[model samples]
Target: MGTFTHGATEWDVACPRRPSRVAGLTMAGFRVRDLDPLRMVPHPAVTLLLEFGAGSTVLDCAAGRQERGSIVAGPGLGTGGAVRARGVNVECVQVRLSPVIARAVLGASPADLDGAAVPLGDLWGREASRLREQLGDVPSWQDRFALTEALLARRCAAGPPVDPEVAWAWHRIAVSRGLARVDGLAAEVGWSRKRLWSRFRSQLGLPPKSAVKLVRFDHAAHRLVAGEAAARVAADTGYADQSHLHRDVMAFTGATPVALAAEPFLAVDDLAWPGHGTPGRPHVPAGQRPVRGPESAQPPH
Candidate 1:
C-alpha cells in the first residue's frame, strides 16, 4: 500500500499483486480520510465501486442527484463535467471493467446504466450486501481482492458475453487509443455500418464516436496531469491543435489544462493503475508532496 498525495488531497491506495482470474478486469483499493471535492472525469470503461468498511462513497451529480455507498456507473458517467466526489473516511474497491466483458460481469450491458450510477443493491439485491460484509470482514487487502475476483469470475462465467465482433471492435478502439474508425471496424467485421453502430451502442453504453472521443480525451487528460503542456498533449494525442485540446478539456472538466494538472483523480492514477494504458502510462506528476506512514483502508461516501 502507498499514499497518493497531491496538493491538498491524500489517500491510501493499494493495487492487487496479481491480475484478476478473469480477463479484461482490473481492481484498486482506496482509503481517504478527507476526500477533497474532486471532479469526476469521463473515461471509456465501466466503473463498479464496491464501497465497504465504516465510511461511504458519495458522488454528487450536477442533476441534484447523490449516490451513496456501493455503485455501478456506466462508461462516461460524468460527461460534460456533471459530477464531483467528496467525503471523509471513504474506502472502497474500484473496478474498471473493459467494455467487452462488462456485459457478462455486470449482468447487463453498460447501456442499461443510462449514463448514471445505480446502487449496487438495486442490481445485485442481497448479494451486494453480502459482498460488502465479506469485503469488510476480510483480514487484508489481498484477501478482499481474492474474494472479489472469485465472485466476478463466477458471475462472468455464468453470464452471456457481448458479441465477439463487438468485443473485437472495442479492443481495437482501446488499443488504438481511440484512433480506430467505425467504418473500418464494420468492414473488417463483415457487417453493415448500421448494424455495427446499433450493436455497439446497445452493448457498450455509448455510441462508437463517443467512446473514441472519451478514450482519446482520457489519454490527453492524463498527459496534462503529468505536467506536459497542453500544446504538446494535443499534438501527441491526435487533437487538431492546442486550442482544440483546450476546448475539449473545458467541455469535459469545466476547467483549463493547468487546473486539471492538479486534480487528485488523475494524480492518483500512477499509484492505483500504473499500467492504465498502452503505448505508455501517463507520467502523472507525483510532485514534491509530502509522504508519511501508510494509511489503513478507507471508505467513500
Candidate 2:
C-alpha cells in the first residue's frame, strides 16, 4: 500500500500482488480518510466497484444520474466529462474486467450499460449485499482479493463466454493499443465488415471503430500523463497531427492535453496497475486459442 496526502485527506491505495485466477480480471484496493471528489476518466474496461466501507461512495454522472454504494460502470465512462466520485471514510475493492469476459463475470452484456454506472445491487440483487459483508469481514487486503477472485471465478464459470472471433478481435485491438484497423480485424476474423461491426458493438458496448479510437486515446492520454509532448505522442500513437490528438483528448476528456496530463486518476494508474501490459505473450491469430492472463485483460473503465 502507498500513502499519500492530497490537501487535508489521507489516502491508502493497494494493488494485489497475485494476478487474478480468472482470466481477464485485475483488482485493487482503496481506503480514504478524507473526502475528495475523484474525477473518473474514460477507459476501455468494465469496472466493478465493491464497497465495504462504513460510508457509501457517491457517483455523480454528467447526465444527471447519481448512484451510491457498490456500483458497476461500463466502458467509456466520463466521456461526457460528467462522472465524478466522492466519499467519506471509504474502503473499497475495485475490479476491472475485460469486455470479452465481462458478460461472464458481470452477468450482463457491456452494451446494456451504455457507458453508465449502475448500482451493483441492481444487477446482482442480494448477492451484492452479501459480497460487501464478506469483503468487510476479511482482515487483510490479500484475503479480500482472494475472496473477490473466488466470486468472480464462480460467476465466470457459470456465465456465458464471448464468441471466440470476438475475443480474438478484441485482443488484437488491445495488443495494438487501438491502432488496428477495423477492416483488418474483419479480415482476420473472416467476418464481413458489416457483421463484425454489428457483433462487436452489440457485445462489447462499442463499435470496432469506436474501440480503436478509445483504445488509441487511452494510450495517448497515458503518454501525456507521463510527460510526453502532444506532438510526439500523436506521431507515435498514429494520430495524424497534434491537432488531431488535441481533438481526441477533448472529445474523450473535455480537457486539454496539459490539463488531462495532471489528472489524479491517470496519475495513480502507475501505482495501482504496475506491470500493466506484460510482454512475451505471443499474439495468437484470429480463430486460435484464446489468450489468457492480464496481458489479454481489458483496461479499466
Give each prediction's root-mean-square deviation over alpha carbons.
11.4, 5.2
Question: In candidate 2, what are the lDDT values of residues 1-301, reduced to their tens digit?
Answer: 9865665777788988877767678888989866588778798888999999587799988757789999998889889567889988889998888888788888889999998999999889999999999999999998999999999989988987777667777887888888887787766666678987888888788888888888888888888989999999999999999999999998888889998998877877777777662211223223434333324533221
Winning candidate number (TM-score): 2
TM-score of 2: 0.91
- Model 1: lDDT of residue 135: 96
**Tens-digit lDDT track for model 1 on 165-236?**
566667667767867776777665556779879998998888888878888888899888888888899999
lDDT of each: 0.79, 0.81
Off by over 4 Å in 2: 277-301
Q: Model 1: runs farther than 4 Å from truth? A: 277-301
